[model samples]
Target: MSTLAGEFKSAYSAGSGDALAAVFTPIGTQNKPYRLQSFYDFTNAASLQKDLSFALFHGKSLKVPRAEQTAWVDIFAAYWEAVGELLKYEQDWPGASLVAIFTAWKKVANALIRGYSSSAGIPAWTLPCLYTVGKYLRTFAINADIKAAPQGASSFGFQDDVAADIEKNAHLEEAARIINRMFTLCLSDRAPMEESRKWGIYQTTNLIFKTYFRINSVGLTKNLLRAINAQSADLPPLEAFPKSHIVTFEYYVGVIHFLDENYAEVREDAFFRVIGLTQLMQAEKHLATAWSMCHRGASKNRELILTYLIPCHLVTTHTLPSDQLLAPFPRLEKLFRPLSNCIRKGDLVGFDKAMSAGEEEFVKRRIYLPLERGRDIALRNLFRKVFIVGGFEEAKEGQTSLRRTRVPVVEFAAALRIGTHATGRTRIDMDEVECLLSNLIYKGLMKGYIARERGIVVLSKNNSAFPGTGV
Candidate 1:
């Protein structure tokens, strides 16, 4: 075995493919000194150190203390080297050899990574290795001529070497299997629940998922999220992760939930730390804020726009004036300022116009659906504003100077019709206005009720009309 290894090493160094092939040739006999092994033997042996070389594209490295960290990196390096050499001989190698090579490297590398993560349950080193594996899989898919069908094709059009037409794409299936294996580790008990640790895991997993998604393997995202959520109690505080990871994970996960039509989940997870804003460009922040608008993000859409998106669009956070920071994003101001004011002032009609004017831009940015959901928030704001502005300060005879306010529902409906004319739209229906008020009351946006006989809204004065804004 040592003699053959020596001959293969010399040939590989001298670029002698024929000689290396001859070295790996199986000589089967009962009396043979030992069974001839191939790439499998090369990978498991210490000689991998000598054969290793870094690839052109790089994977991130981190300060981690896993055993044989250098050895693992070297193993990856050697795998790339073997892949490079095989490419040179690809035209000459038999078809069986090509498939065998792909199968052996993929299987061995995946098992090695899964072993480390499973054993230590630490994402520190395991996460970095996963990126390299993901990169390799991407390369493998391209080289194999694997084509990704449209996202919801139900069946991957590509197939394995098998002649059967009914089989799914072998490459996609294998990659997904490997990804899920590592993903399950993130939910394990000892898997370091710190934010930074999980951040690494999520980022690397997203990268792998991106590759898999190209081949129509996105259905697995829901499955993977279910596993992670099942273990959410075991996860750490998100603040422990660097702000950058928090932003990225939230964006990706939110989008997945959005795609899944899980609107509430998307909204709940839209809370973003302000620290990561510098890491993204203005357009990127714009897109994220647009996504947040979908569910009003607990009514923080206004705050997100004010604190992050406005600063990004107008001047960077660095140049933001203590006075009127939104000078640069004038167009954004035109679109959202009225909406914000309407939200604050209970001007539903104006809010509707502002939303209409920005619809084109929002659609162009692909945030229309999410932003549309902001209507509920606008209604909430409008209701609060109307009760405050229109409520009368009347003295009740029997009560200790009770301040009573009563306004007709028709007056409320008129305010909702304010900006519609600009868009060539007609006045909003009275029933629609009543229905919206019903929702506002139901959602605790105000302490009020419709006096159906008189067609008026009577608001309570014991506390502020808006709920949760304690004075």
Candidate 2:
């Protein structure tokens, strides 16, 4: 095998398409080798170096003293631009067939990432290389040909070629097979109790799970959980790392459990774990008081709004008053402040607006836009349910009725602690104005019969909707 340095020199000098294609001839008959060479010629070198430096040296794979993964990432990034350009020029090729190839590579890359995480097992700061590798790997996979089983398997217990090969062959189903086998092996020892090296191994396992989670590959996630349970020993509790990861994980798990209608388990297991992780992160004290206040409010731990949520809002603020300042965490303060405010006030309207604003800001900063976009959509949907109840204007099909009205209910009423309103000039949700006409129930509003079925508010005299019920 050629030394990495020698390969780099040869690949670098192989400037043109023919020369680049030559570099990969030794690897295989597949077009991926040529594509890799073409990629290096097209991509920027300095930026790749910078990103790789941080990922490889600072995070996971600290146990493995090699920069090969990082190099692979850099190579793949360049390869993408090159091959994509070539494909763009090749108008004669069928787009559908090429797309299938991309799909196959995507699976292969995911499997590689999971396999590496299982093998390396280290902190995030030390494994930046993995990120770069995984990024292009996933990109390649997405673009690979996703059809038949690849011809180059059984050597590595999987296919031998990179994502480019799969795309060329359109062997997605076979690529998926190889990927699944790798995934199965990677997750074979998922449970924390199965292995003695708890910290790194557990964290890496979670990382692998997160890879699946990121893709919404719930089947893989379920299989991983099963493996963990099967391998786990009936022993004491497990400790987590970075604290933030645990907090984030528990939060997602709780959401899953909640969706599954396992409310009791969510409260008992997920809630406590999240709370503990938050505390461990020193979010309760190390940060500003507002953050602590908001955190408490978000958890609904007490009726009073804790200062925790403030930090989330403060993070978003470009400027803040000296007295109400957030922490000094760059960019984060600006990002968190508005979210915290929305959570603290239980203002679904505010949350929706803030989330949109956050996404725009992230895009402007050239940050990862997709994650924020997904998050924005998620929060928007979440608050939509909490803020407004949709209903049609049920008047005669062709006739507009003046008496037509819609009913509204506060989704967060159970959590919002305040004075009740029987009837008066109350500021109801903007979207739920129709619902307000039928029922104006508040902590200290009008005293009357809530005719929920008919969507009518029977109030006393001087009340907004009903004058005879009670003011």
User: Once superposed on the true structure, which residue ranges of model 1 sit more than 4 Å away at CA?
Assistant: 1-78, 81-127, 135-174, 184-219, 225-370, 383-391, 396-404, 425-428, 468-471
Best by TM-score: 1
Report the Cα lDDT for residue 220, model 1: 62
Cα deviation at 5, candidate 1, in Å, is 17
lDDT of 1 by residue, 184-266 (tens): 54445363344234545565556555555554445566666676677676666666655544554554454443333322324
- Summarize candidate 2's per-residue lDDT along 1-471 as a digit string, tens digits: 122233433443443323332432222235343443444344354575554344334444233444445544544444343344345435455553545434433543553345345444422222322333333343333334332436652221111221222323323333333444444443443445434233233344444443443343434555655665775563224443445434433433332332232122134355654543344233323333323323432432211112222322222221122323435333455665665555444454555566677765433322222222223223323323333333233567786533212222343232121212322324545335333322333312223444556644333322232222121
lDDT of each: 0.49, 0.37
TM-score of 2: 0.32
Candidate maximizing lDDT: 1
lDDT, model 2: 0.37
Residue pairs whose backbone atoms clash in candidate 1 = 294-370, 346-382
